[model samples]
Target: MPRRSYDHYCAVSRALDVVGDRWSLLVVRELCSGPRRYSDLFADLPGISTDMLAARLKDLERDGILTRRKVGPRAGTAVYELTADGAALRPVLDSLSTWGTSQLGERRATDAVRAHWFALPLGRAIAQRIPAGTATVHIGDSAFHYVITEAGITHHDGPAATPDLELRFDLSTATEVATGVRSLADAIERTAPQVSAP
Candidate 1:
């Protein structure tokens, strides 16, 4: 099947033409952390059907946004990772996360929550204070780490092998910090989060 487009020559429209599908950007968001197997992607994305995930992955690959590669012994397993072009969408996702902060008033009963989902926004919120170090944040059972540098921040799923700092937060506090309702610095000062050097 052919892709539908606004057919406008504008840059935004062109970008949208590639990634404007319902679950495309969210797929990108999941991959932003690191390479993931198809099962990993499906498990994390709560409501998407298997067919839809497969279709989106194919579309993203065709557009040069990501690449699917075989890894491990006998090349039995495949993982999907972002191409450089797709990784460049980090700042774009950051901008949207910032913009959407206002809409995150409270977690609803129907909302699906994943701790790593807060990684990007929390990275942005804490970048200034912990300007150039790796931190592994634990929010309940889920863990993710961020590497901050002069270039920018990049987050990855799971814990860092040797994080300079470790932060532990309850989901509520983490959400508040990520959504800008509460400042990380304030959270630290108030002892709402447990922070340690490791």
Candidate 2:
């Protein structure tokens, strides 16, 4: 089936033609951490149906945004990873995240939350302070880490094996930090979060 398009000769329109579908960008967000099995993607995306998820994956793959490959000891496992083109969307995601922060007024009863979902915004906040280093952040029962360098910041799904700094905070504080309502420095100063060098 052919994709619907604005048929305009505009870069933004072309880009949207590829990723404007529902769940596409969110799928890209999940893969931003790293490659993930189909099951992992399905689990993280709360409301998407299995058929919809498969269709989106196929579309993204067809568009050269991602690729599925076999990995593991015997190469029996398959995982989906972003291609170079897909990884290029990181900045786009960052921009959208920044713009959407003020729109996140309050958590609703029906809203689903994930700890790693805070990684990007918190990473941006942390980079302003630390600038460069490995920091493992613990938000409630979930753990994620950020690696900041002269180049840029990249976040991962799990804790660093040896982090230069360790931060512990509750989900509320994390949400505040991610949404830009509270600064990480303020959170540290207020002692709502415990930060230490390890």
Could you say which candidate leads in TM-score?
1
Q: Per-residue lDDT of 151-170 in model 1, one digit per residue for the tens? A: 99999988889998778888
Candidate 1 residues lying further than 4 Å off, grouped into runs, are 189-193
Q: Name the lDDT value of residue 151 in candidate 2.
A: 79
Q: Estimate each model's TM-score.
A: 0.94, 0.92
Model 1 clash count equals: 0
Query: What's the C-alpha lDDT at position 75 in model 2?
Result: 95
- lDDT score, candidate 1: 0.91
lDDT for 1 in candidate 1 is: 100
Give per-residue CA lDDT, model 2, range 78-118, as digits (tens). Answer: 99999999989988999999998888889999999998888
